[model samples]
Target: MNVLFNTDKLTRLIANLQTFTGIRTNTFDAAGKDIQLSGGHSDFCRLINASPEGHARCEACDARAVEKCLTARNAYSYRCHAGACETVLPVFESGTPIAYLVFGQLLDDSSVKQQWENAEKELGWYQGDLAELKEAFLRLRRFSPREMAAYAEILEALAQYIQQEGIIRSAEYSDLQKLEMYLDRHYMENLSLKRISADLHMGTTKLCTLSKKLSGGRTLTWLIAQRRVNAAKSLLLKSDEPVSSVAESVGFSDYNYFTKIFKSVTGITPSAYRKTNRS
Candidate 1:
């Protein structure tokens, strides 16, 4: 769960983006912790967040947006509960999402009147100066649909730049840790390189590379076989199950292949290992 990045440089870049685009930008880590890089929230949002209920709703809205973006694996745009437009773009490293770039807090020019009416209805639940809130809401920067699309493109490019520049990355050790954990949990199932790669949201080649690194230069198949053999050894010593049963229980469908792999890994057949290790 360790994230590495240059905070100062990221903050500077976000700030400059905000200055140029008139749209605030922020980043959220995989765990959904916000890293506020650009300037503060817009005056309209600030007024809404001032109320306790408004703050809670805003948090929930953001969480839902982030979840949708992660599921879509692309930029997601939506109108917030308070009626401002926002977009969330996920940042990925080697097919794994590491962070998100959230930009937008403007009024869509075509929908301003409707948005204002909706915001006024929702604002009744919040204890704020209604007139001041309305004024701030009206003052929010407005964008046409085409302009919003342009900003979305800009944010998408920025996300790629962030990855290329290593503005955010999951540590190599963490990557290895996750890979090992996944293998440990599912070694007994029917496993394959494509399945594991897809489940881990990693490329097949990268999965193989990390597996080799984890197993001290062995291939990913070796790691899986090693896990299955280790489990088979435990079963052989602890239980009197038949050799075929033990192999099958540990994901070895073919008993003969299991024997081959067990000998390769443990330097003995399963039965021999059990007999020698047992009291």
Candidate 2:
């Protein structure tokens, strides 16, 4: 398959997968760890972020794979992540799996009859109930085999593009991270685009452009506000600090503004946040 490795095309491919297959694509750097996973109908992104599934399984499975790969050496596929029922496909470049594309377990025309038969065959050997499995199978959405092949081709192109374009190792995000880390450390201080730009030896306008790109289109001020709000979450969890105190600690001088922004981002007031955590 022809692969375009530029950023614009990569973003478009990711968007298309989300639109068509209802599956999300996650890319890793040269390392096996995930950089980001998005655009999936399943909340597997959230699960992978907080749960010990993919990487943990990969570590153990990597060693055991040599024995299993006796039948297939050219390409390797295995699914043991909590049996979440989604298939994970590894995208390789020069024989190394650099990115993983996840699809399947969706509800489609053939899944019902096929899964029921398979479940019955393995029912005595497997731990999960066949009825529950059937129910879960029926609930999910499925893509046709043609759709699967199309998505696979797009992902293969994306993987090739990532390897050739150096997108994974780009220094473009470093300055943004530096500014974010600086703000994280010194948010309580007087912070503005001017002061931060001066410190980083960048112009305010350029900084603004980078800020939007790096923060997923959130302006610099919004990013700071989000940081403050996130900090308030931690304080709510770990400290008995009053709402106003937590607000001040995170750089919001005005308690009302803090409450407004915190609620806007988290859908709960700071007081409610603390109370829920406490309860």
Candidate 3:
């Protein structure tokens, strides 16, 4: 399920908070999928990212925490799978929970050496350089329990904001968020109206109507293509992979067609864009 909050506004808030609190934060839907800042994942998360087994374990950890918050009917904090403290604040709608404002991955007050040893054990068998992981652990934001409570209050306020704004901008934007969530999950695939509408369980026409309204008149296809182009741009700028491979990675199968769309959307060829960005 999508978070019932303004992601852009929340992102801006998270960014600003980092400047003051030096703590990273993220919001997740009730299902544990990140919807906002989710701040640069902790160093230990980087290790888990490398191994599918460990990633699954971490997901299960998140699932359990989400379950506890949903069942307990209150916001709470728990230690992450990687030995860092984290909190989950459920955002409710009309007396039902819809999303969670998650803040955490901070180190507890203790000996740094012991913390690393415990983190290595908690992270289990994974493949990133342990030294790097240690560095990341050392760099994590640390706070006392009192400070954490104060930070969580910020997320609570934002959650309340989402609940209020949602009343004024309900169904239309909800449909928009649903579409965005779908695109975020399936952006790597060859997507189309029939498939997207099917997933949302709505007719293509209504889907298009909502997409148009949500995007201020841009068609559903526009958003899909834009998402792909944006991904392609990231790959182009960040990786040394070839243009054709980058195009394919972002859901474009035909290299020439990918170039056409890339140029059309970005006003430059992929190679040129890459070179310019590199320079």
Give lDDT per model, in order. Answer: 0.87, 0.60, 0.78
> lDDT value for candidate 3?
0.78
Candidate number with greatest lDDT: 1
Off by over 4 Å in 2: 1-170
- Model 3 quality (TM-score): 0.56
TM-score of predicted structure 2: 0.42
Model 3 Cα displacement at 156 (Å)? 1.8
Q: Which ranges of candidate 3 are over 4 A from the true structure?
A: 1-5, 167-279
lDDT of 3 by residue, 202-279 (tens): 888888888887678988877777888999999999999999999999999999988998899999999999999989
Itemize residue pairs with steric clashes in candidate 3.
26-38
lDDT, candidate 1, 32-88, per-residue tens: 567766689989888888878998998888889999988999989998888888988
In angstroms, give how far residue 27 of model 1 lies from its true place: 1.0
Q: Write the per-residue lDDT of candidate 2 for residues 107-165, one digit (tens) a residue.
A: 33465677556535533443334465456545556665566566566655665666666
Clash count, candidate 1: 0
TM-score of each: 0.62, 0.42, 0.56
